[model samples]
Target: MKPRGTFRNTALALGLAFLYLPILSMMVFSFNNSRLVTVWDGPNSPTLKWYAKLFENSQILDAALLSVKIAAMTATGAVVLGTLAGLVLVRFGPFRGRAMLSAMTTAPLVMPEVITGLSLLLLFVALEQLTGWPEGRGVLTITIAHITFAMAYVTVVVQSRLAGFDDSLEEAALDLGAKPAKVFFAITLPLIAPALVSGWLLAFTLSWDDVVISQFVAGPSATTLPMVVFSKARLGVSPDINALATIMVLVVATGVVLSSVWMRRQERKRRLEEQMARSDAG
Candidate 1:
C-alpha cells in the first residue's frame, strides 16, 4: 500500500510537471536580461525591459486588440446562436430536421481545423465572387469563421446543461400566469446562465487561440496575436514573446482564480440556504 501510494503521488507530480514546467520556464525566461531566451545571464539578470519593449511594439499591441475584438464578437455571436440551437434541440422536442440540425451543429467539433479553415476560405471566396458582399477577407470574415466553429462548442455546453436540468420550475412557471417567452427569459435563461458563461468563455478562448483558421481567412491588415506569435516563433523565441505569454498567463490565471472563488461562495450560500430550509421544515 505504501509503495502504491508513493507511485501514485509520483505519477501525479510527474503529470503536473509535464503540463506546467514549460509554462513555468517561459514565465521565468520572460524576466531574463539576456536576449537568448534559454539562458539566464547572472544572479542579477532579472529585468522588466522585455515587458516594457512588449508594450512599445505597436504591431503586437494592434494584433492583440484586434484579437480581443474578434474574440468578443465571436463569443457573443456563438452564444446567441448556440443557445437557440440548444433550446431547439432540447426543449422544442423532435421537430422536422432534428437529426440534421444536431448533426450540423456538432460537425465542426469532429472536423479538422485545416479542413474547416479551407472550406470557410472557399466559402468566402465564392461569396465574394457571387454577391461581392464581403469585399475583402478581414475582420468580418475572421469573426464569421470563428463563430461558425465556436458555436458548435457552445451548443454542446448548453445542450448538456439543458439535458440535466429539472424542468419542474419551468413547468410551474407555465402553469401559473407566465407566458412561454417570459418563462424562458426569466427562468430558463437565468438557470442556464453558468452554462452560457462557460460557453462564451470557451468560444472566446477558441477564437483568441486560433491561428490556422485566421491565417486562411485574414487579410493583409488583419493579423491576429496568435498569427504574430507564430510568425515570430518560426524564426526564434524572443524575450518580448515570452513577456507577452507571461502576461496572458497571468490574465488567465487571475480569471480562473476569481471564478473559482465566486463559484465556491455561491455553493456555500446554496448549502446554507438548504440547511436553513431543512431547519424550518423540522
Candidate 2:
C-alpha cells in the first residue's frame, strides 16, 4: 500500500510537471534579456524591456482591445440565448420540436471549427447579397459568429445544471401564489447562477481564444489578438510575444485567485449564517 501510494504521488507530480513545464518555461523566458527566446543570457539575463516594448506595439494593443470587445459581446449574447434555450429544454415539458432544438443547440460541439467557420462565412455573404444588412464582415460579424458557436456550449452547461435541479421549490413558489416570471427571477435564477457564471466565462474564453472562426468572419479592419499572434508566430516567436503572454498569464492567475478567495469567503459566510439561524431556532 505504501509503495502504491508513492507511485500514485509520483505519477500525479509527473502529470502536473508535463502539463505546466512549458508554461513555466515561457514565463521564465519572458523575463530574459535575449531576443532569441530559446537562449538564456546568464545570471544577469532578466529584463523588463520586452514588457515595455509590448505596450509600444499599437497593432497588438488594438487587436487585444478588439478581441476583448468581441469576447464581451459574445459572452453576453450567448448567455441570454443559451439560458432561454436551456429553460425551453428543461422547463417547457414535451414541447414540439424538442429533439430538434436539443440537436441544434449541441450541433456546434460536434461540428468541426473549419466547417463552422466556412458555413458562417457563406451565411454572412448570402445575407449581405440578399439584404445588405451586415454590409460586410467586421466586429459585428465576428461577435455574431462567436455567439453562434459559444451559445451551444453555454446551453449544454445550463441544461445540465437544470437537469438535476429539484422542481419542488418552483412548484412550492407557484403554490404560494408567486408568478412564473417572479419565481424564475428569484429562486430559479439564483440557484442556477453558478452555472450561468460558468457558461459566461466559458463563452468568453472561447471567443477570446478563437482564431479559425474569427479568421473567416472578421474584416480587414477588425484583426483579433489570436490572428495577430498566429501571424507573428509564423514569422518567429519574439520576446515581446512571450512578455505579452506572461502578462496575460498573470492577469488570468490573479482573476482565478481572487475569485477563489471571494467564493471561499462567501461559502464561509453562508455556513455561519446557517449556523446562527440553527442556534436561534434551537
- Which structure among the candidates has the greatest TM-score? 1
lDDT of 2 by residue, 89-199 (tens): 998899899999999999999999999999999999999999997989899999999999999999999999999999999999999999999999989999999999999
Tens digits of per-residue lDDT for model 1 on 113-140?
9999999999999999999979899999
Q: Check candidate 2 and list the clashing pairs.
A: none
- How well does candidate 2 score on lDDT at residue 135? 86
- The lDDT of model 2 is 0.94
Q: All models: lDDT?
A: 0.96, 0.94
Residue 216 miss distance in model 1 (angstroms): 0.4
Best by lDDT: 1
Residue 13 miss distance in model 2 (angstroms):
2.8
Candidate 2 lDDT trough over 10 residues, lowest sum? 1-10
